[model samples]
Target: MVETGRIRVAKDKADLVKSLISTDGATGPFQTFADAIAFAAALGAKHNRRVPLGEISKREPSPIRLEYFASMGHDCVIKLLAITETKDIKILSLTEESEAKRNLIFEEYANGGLEILQNELRGAVDYSERILLMLCPEREQQEQQNEEFDLSKFLS
Candidate 1:
């Protein structure tokens, strides 16, 4: 039961990481890649373990990942990278986007114009998951795309 509890906690942590990564739109600017990394690191640290940054760095992450990270927030990305290096975890470049572009993304996310804020919250969760995978290339898995970006399908 103790081991099961630990496993459950780890799974929850992983899910939280996924959510942080894929969140999108204007609840605020999408979390920067740095934020995502820090969140992940904190989660690991809380468990008294460190992420395998050295191993992750050795693998080349996809360009989309670099662009996404850069877009989320460049400064955060740099800090995360430095931390990863110090921790001997592998670091990979993901998506890189400018502040302007990232704000535009938030604008689009707010498009329902406040009428559908509740509905938008659900979408935001899905977006967070997608973004997380985008930053952590090693976590990418081959899954079928849903029709019209269907959240039910993706989340299911």
Candidate 2:
């Protein structure tokens, strides 16, 4: 504990994230999907850039996901994540969510924190595979008059 004019502060980000995720601790970035949507609409009223939100999926069994992006940024995120028992090589955007999604969390740590977390997850699994499936519900239509902004040009 560090003292600042008599007010003490935890010396680490992990400490902060730890306290927040604990039961009876502060509530997370979103309480529910509707709350998330409303926060997104308001450009993040409860959370900010400095704080990373720990969001648990609302699906039955409710797996936790550490959000790297802000509320409004979550608008482009694919909602439904398919958890499979086996890993398929043909998938993109596929990465281990965590050792166990239920009550899972990734806290900021000093000294190879991410490496430790990834290593922990690496050895603990064969548990489940998480995949992102694209859902473009729009019907096929003819090309419009608007100019297409091709991102491929930036790749080279």
Give the number of the best model, judged by lDDT.
1
lDDT of 1 by residue, 18-112 (tens): 34443453333235434444343333333334322111121211112334444555435344434443453332223232332332222222222
Model 2 agreement with the true structure over 45-117: per-residue lDDT tens digits: 2122112233322332122232422243532222211122123322223333322221111111111232222
**What TM-score quantifies how close candidate 1 is to the native fold?**
0.24
CA deviation > 4 Å runs, candidate 2: 1-38, 45-48, 53-75, 78-92, 97-156
**TM-score against native, each model:** 0.24, 0.17
Model 1: residues with Cα > 4 Å off, grouped in runs = 1-14, 19-35, 42-48, 53-64, 74-156
Candidate 2 is scored at a TM of 0.17
- Residue 32 accuracy (lDDT) in model 2: 41
Worst 10 residues of 2 by lDDT: 130-139
lDDT minimum window of 10 residues, candidate 1 = 1-10
